[model samples]
Structure formats: structure tokens, C-alpha cells
Target: MEKKNNRYSLLLVGLAVLLVVGLVFTVGRSKKPTLNVYNWSEYLPAEIITAFEKEFGVKVNYDTYSSNEEMLAKLSTGATGYDIVVPSDYAVSIMIHQDLALPLDKEALPNLANIDPRFLDLYFDPGNVYSVPYLWGTLGIAYNKTKVEEPVTSWEILWDPKYKGRIVVVDDMREIIGMALQTLGKSRNSTDPAELMAAKAKLATLVPAIKAFDSDNPKGHLLSGEAWLGVLWSGDAALAGMENPDITYVLPEEGGGLWMENLVIPKGSRNPELAHEFINFILRPEVSAKLAEAFPHGNPNQAAHALIDPEILNNPASYPPAEALEKAEWLIDVGEATVLYDQIWTEIKGGR
Candidate 1:
């Protein structure tokens, strides 16, 4: 009986030791680091995120916002937990001025060498201190070849009476008004109230003809044959072209907005080093090429250009000719004039 009791006591002690060891292992293994990324909707490919997770064993919490304004408003509220953000060129300038973005550590981003020099040290975020260009594109017109009687080479095609109720315009106020401004031979960043009013008037005149104002999925309308023509970002146009070969993208004769979406680390990030790691990961030639394939945008990574699909590389919409690029203008921070733009845009949308 004494020997049996000793054996029972030994079994209980062994079980207790095993339980403690298991708990310690579980706790240590469960504390994986997380990276929170806020980006534009549909901007990144799923495989990129999956690959990053697999490589680093760091969990990614990805979220998306539609516009720069929406992202800025959320960040302005002092809400935390975002380790990275993707903002456009002008928005980067605003965030920098407002001290909403953090300076990037160049040493950590050695892969920055892959980016083309042409995209760097721009007027916005000059010296490339706080942001890195991700994808760039022009705002242009996309038209279904079967629906349009005439070749669409100009922005004036939107105002044509024949296309009434068959046109889709981007919902973005800046982009829409910028198109009008460009058509009227004025700067997209025009602060002149007269120029803005003229642009608003033009838009108001065309409003009755417009089928819908859509940003999230203008390509859907075009694909469904609901909208015969649309003012779209070049990337969206490229997507439309791929899904339906009948669709064609053209840079209007009047020129258009050239935009560069950039990757930035917002202030108060919990994981700055991880953010840098992710940026460098994205900048890798192969990864950058994959991003271009997914989004069909103009890749700023020169090294990645060689790795892109030949068909995509040859597509004029994805890589506009030199003349088109020469005519294109980048949207710049217009300072307090933005208030006037807001007012004008409201008037246009309100049908005033």
C-alpha cells in the first residue's frame, strides 16, 4: 500500500510539471507581433500580404479607405493602431505640413534604390523623406468601342449631346473639377475663383447627361454597358481594358491629372520598424512587379519594369507615351484655396 501511494504521488507531480511547461510554451508562441496597414481599397494584391506574413511570421491587420480625405479625417481624430498608410502626392504634402506622417529611416529601406529617380524628390515630400511612390497613373477617359460612334480622344466627348445618360464620371470632386479645369485650359490647382466658377458651370451643364458619379467601381458601369464612357484613373481603365477587350483608354487632348500614390508611415505608429520592413518588402523588384500586374498602374520601381508581363508593359494605358506625359500635370497642394474648391464643388454638385 505504501509503494502504491508513492507511485500515485509521482504521477501527479509529473502531470503538474507537464502542464506548466505547456502553458509557458503556448504563452510565448501566442505573442506574435501585428502590423496594421491602412491603404486604398483594392490597391494591394492578396498574395503580397500573404507572402509578407509567411516570410516574417508577423500578422498583418489590413484596412482600406476610399479617399485621402476619409483617411485623414480618421487619423485626425487621434485614433491609434495604424502602422502604415498609403496617401497620394498632394495628401502626403498636407500630412507632412500637419505633422501627421513620420520621417522614414533610409538605412532600413535599402531597397529604395529600386525606385526610379524621376519619381523621387518631387515638389511634394521633396528629398523623399516621408513617403515613397507606390503606383502612379493619369486620369483619362475610357470608352467602349461598340457604344461610341466617334473616336473619343478629347474630354469634350463627355459633353456631347449624343452620349447623354451614357457617361460616368468619377465621384471625386477634385478629379471631376480638375477635368473641367483642364478642359478650360486652366490649372487643376487653380485658385482663381473665376476659373473655378467656369469649371463648375461646365460640370453643371454636363450633369444632366451623366449616368452616374462613381469612384469605387466606375469600371463596373462600363463593363455592364450601363455607361458607354467614363472618366477613370488609368489603372481602372487598364482593368476595364483587360476584362473587356472592347474598352479603350485614351489621354484626352486637353491633358489630365497625373497622380502618384505613396506609402507612408503615419505619426504615432506602434510598429515603425515593421512598417519600414513592409515598405522595403514592397519595393523589392519581384514584389513591385506583382503589384503592377495586380493594379495595372505605372510602376515607379525601375527595377521592377523588367519583370512585368510583356503585354502589360506594352499597354499604352499603363505606360502613356512621352507626349501624353509631357502634357500631364501633377496635383499640388493649393493651400487655403482648397476652401474655395470645396465651395465650388458643393455648388456644382448641388446644381446651383
Candidate 2:
């Protein structure tokens, strides 16, 4: 009787060990890794994220911010655990300097060759180390053609006293000030204290004429016809025109800021592989085209551009011709100049 009991006890112990191992394996397989993406407000199509979730069986937690500074502040805390982030050209440079991002592993992304070479090797990330170009466009004026009597081709219209309480501009400091600087025949990325101050003065002249400083939906101002003219990103202008064709986009004679938004991986993410997969998925021509169709931004994917509707592709406001791109200046990080720009912006906006 004693021998039989010992044999049964041993068998029961072995079954317990097998059950524990099976439970561990099942738990591991059940927990799908999550990918976190932080991007600009209204920057992406909703369906793309859904599609990624469906295909990869991973949950995507997407969030957005209106400004680069806001994004930086949240990310500085290191608690967000975001796997991917999309920041504008200058912001990418700043993040890289502060060690907020990781250098991408090029071997993992074979689709890197699809990006236009013109956008590659930018001053921000030489050799495209930390970021990949997502979209590129110039800052231009969007105005109601029916309200304005003449052709608008200059930044001066935003300052016109005749349009007092009828003008809107982006709330962004660099972009708003850049418009003024470019109007004064200076680079948008100008580091000269005197030039920035001059730009401040120009902005001062337009302040009272403006209705409100808006960032998220500058197009709403134009669409409602509450403001006849506004400074708009090319994508916003295109969206506005779709609702009202009378809204016209104008590139100033003195040139405007040419901006590019890019995708980057922040440091210490939980799911770098999943983030890479998301990036690769978006780079696919069809997925890229869907983003362009949804947001109307200037897509850098040449293959995606072919997939977009001809009317959208032909839209002057959204995709300005190569000639217009020639005179425009891409914004570069201005190290110490950022503080100066902020001071001037504070003085102007605060009316001090």
C-alpha cells in the first residue's frame, strides 16, 4: 500500500508541472504587444490605425498634440512609453540633440529607398539617421476669392487694415513670425536678432487686424467666411477648398517656409519591432495614398502620389509646382535663436 501511494503522488506532481507550463505559455500568447504612436493633431487617417491593428493583432494607442513644444514636454517625463512620434523638421533636430530619440536601424526598413532623395540628407538628420520624411509643403495664404477683389500673392494681405477682424493666422510662433520675416526678404530660419525683431515689428502691424490665433483648425476660419484671409499649411488650405472652391491659396513673392513632418522612434519604447511594422505599413503605396486622401497633405511618396485623385494631385494649393519650391527655405534648428524667437513672440502675442 505504501509503494502504490508513492507512485500516485509522483504522477500527480508531474501533471501539476505540465499544467503550470501550459498556463504560462497560454498567458504569453494571449498578451499582444501594444504599439504607442504620438503624432500631430489630425495628421493621419483613422482607418490606417484600424487596419494595422487588424493585420498585426497588436493594439495601437494613438495620441496627438498641437505643437512640438507640447509634445516635448510630455515626452520629457519618460512615462508615456510612446514607441513612435512624428515631429516637424526642426523639432526632430531638437529632439535628437536632447537624446530623446533613437537612431533608426536601416536594415529593418527596406522601403527607405522609396522616399524622394530631395527630402533625404536634410540638415536635420544627415543620412536620415533619426527620422523619415512623411510629408512636405509650404506655408501659404488661404483667402476667400469672392471677398477679395484682386489676386492675392503677397503676405501683406494678412496685415491689411481693410481686413481688420477678418484675418486669421496660425498660432505657431515660428510659423507666424516666419511669414513676417519672409515678407521682409529674410529666411524663415533666420538667426539674426535684428531680423527676428524686425519680423516681430511686422507681426505687430498685423495683430489687431487678426480675428484669432488658431492652430488646430485654421481652415474653419476660412470655411465659415468669418475671416477672409488666413495663413495656412498647404494641407489645411486644400481641405478648405474642398468645401468652398472660392478659397484660394497663394505663395508669396518673397517665398515662404517650406516645412516637412517626419516620423521618428522615441527612446526606450516597449515595442520597437511593432513600431517598425507600423512605419513599413504606412510606407506602402496604398496606405500612403489613403493618408494623402484623408488629410490632403503633400505626400512625399512618389508612388502614392500616382494613386491619388488627379484633381487633388493637380490642386495648386496642396501641391505647389516645383518652381514655387525653389525659392522656399526649409526651417533648420536655430540652437540659441529658438529662445530669441520665443521672447519676440511672447512680446508680440502678449501685446507687451
Please give the CA lDDT of all the candidate structures: 0.91, 0.87
TM-score of 2: 0.89
lDDT of 2 by residue, 66-121 (tens): 88889988888876799999989989988898899888888877777777788898
Per-residue lDDT for 87-137 in model 1, tens only?
Answer: 999999999988999999999999999999989999898899999989999
- Report clash pairs, candidate 1: none
Assess every candidate by TM-score: 0.92, 0.89
Off by over 4 Å in 1: 1-31
Give residue 303's lDDT in candidate 2 (0 to 100): 71
Error of 1 at 277 (Å): 1.3
Top candidate by lDDT: 1
RMSD per model, one decimal: 2.5, 5.1
Q: Provide the global lDDT of candidate 1 against the true structure.
A: 0.91
